[model samples]
Target: MLAVPLLGLINQYLGFLAMIAAIVLVWKDSPWQKGAKVAATIAAMALLGAVLPDPPEEGAAGVARKDRKAAAARTLTSPSPSAAQDDPSPTTEPRPEAADYRGMRLDEARDKAEAAGFGTSDHNASDDDKNIWMRSNWTVCFQKSSWTGSETKTIDFGAVQTGAPCPSTDGGAIPWPTMPELTWKTWKTARNEVVALGVVPTEHLRADTAYLNDTLPDEGKYDNWRVCATDPLEGADVTINTWVTLELTHPDNGCPDPSQSKEDRVDLPDRDDDGDPDYHDPFPGDRNRNSVFPNGLPDSSGNSSGGDGSDGDSWNCPRTRWC
Candidate 1:
């Protein structure tokens, strides 16, 4: 069997080339001696072919060797999830919780507070401008201190829209809560802190005209209030509970109006250059300044008119009171 297979292999090579050479020699009518020379060359190749291995019989040991090599190759190259399953420890750690108000509008503060376990007991917005005031309550469970009363923590938030002048008018929609200028003012019993986030406008006003005209004598033109502190106060381990009052104020002197009114009168030039009616109240009866009542007095519309406008709902603690 080996001799037959080796002869076939030799014929596939030397015999094929010799046949072509013989055909060429016959076509040229070469001498018969040239054909004998080609035959001799083919026989010499056949003798050398006897050293080569024979083709395997059906399912023979040679065939089994090839099959084993293929199987070993596949085993070496294939992927296995066994190592991954054996690992009990995770490859990656759990991620941290993200901020709740990372990029939302300041007007959404109420919704965020609600989601964070605060109840919206009172909500009001001033018509004169874009100021919104909200009073919310949250239940308290102190670890050590007795519940003489709940502590009141005020989180005053204000938002304003600033952008290129609108082409169509309608005062260009106030972009509240979206691309809004956000300011967070916090009051703890005695200390107050204000923080500004995002792009602030150049013409934003920080002080009411009254305060600017009265307290700051050297003011040329002021717009928007910057946060007084470099860092935000940490809200941790806080006890001694009572209702906290949050009041948004003019960026200038940080004082809440007695009635919680935010109106500011500004003088504008008359159209015809007449001096008689040169000055007018830019924002008259602004609700932002007047929404909070003094000592919880009700207005004509049956709304609280007290200085704080918080009424009995305010948790008046030993150190702080909400107004």
Candidate 2:
């Protein structure tokens, strides 16, 4: 009729073959009877099935473009609840108020705990594993902290170097300086009790005939020498450069008996039994006839110059002992 709804708006199978060629040309030509050509071919196939256009549904236009791109990606990644209450959420800060940075000074208690917001950390409160390089020379001695927040808080501390003295509690350790009873004392009172316990004394002399004048023990004859066995012996703790040693001997040739054995503690004086002892026998009575202590025997200050008179000669050696 109108070419079968204008060929079904351009092709629904050419409007179903133009509505079957317009009902075979109105029933074989000018139809006007046969029930008026079956009511004009059923009103031209219901007006060409109401103007064509129906072949879609298989993937419905790709599910309507994936539901309009998932509603514009949820409206550009959802936001609005008043823009999520005007955006905020990052936080942290708090910390600050906690005191007692012990006797201060670890770089002014880490610059007063980083000006109160807090952070620092430290440790070695002096078991002397030393190393705090120069944080104002050290001091703090104990301090903790926790209220937790200043971007992760911190505090800790326990230091010690500044003239020492701190650990009796809060993270302990420091103390040191103990090793006292320096044997039978006397190398000038065990070098003034190892310089009043600041440590590092070092004497030695264990009698190789008091170094037959290779000198070095006369702090003005340090009370005729004594101390018997030390090197960390008596009590033991030390630190300020540690060392200690002492060992020496001469209280008229004594000390050496806690079950002897420093080569059986020799006090010298073999008077020619020739096992060589009058300071190594330069004829110490050649076989015991009558040598009232000759040549090599005088030194612990009875002084026949085995040195200290400055170079005694006659091969009794000691011109600083042969150089």
Top-TM-score structure, candidate number: 2
- What are the runs in model 2 whose C-alpha is more than 4 Å off? 9-45, 50-75, 78-138, 141-219, 223-226, 230-235, 239-248, 251-256, 259-323
**Candidate 1 ranges with C-alpha deviation above 4 Å:** 1-12, 19-53, 60-110, 113-323
Give model 2's TM-score versus the native structure. Answer: 0.35
Cα lDDT of all candidates, in order?
0.35, 0.66
Tens-place lDDT digits, model 1, residues 107-192: 45546655655433221111225333322221111011111235332233322222211112232332221212123332221222
Model 1 sits at a Cα RMSD from the real structure of 25.3
Worst 10 residues of 1 by lDDT: 138-147
TM-score of each: 0.17, 0.35
State residue 169's C-alpha deviation in candidate 1, in Å.
51
Global lDDT for candidate 1? 0.35
Compute the lDDT of residue 306 as modeled in candidate 1.
32
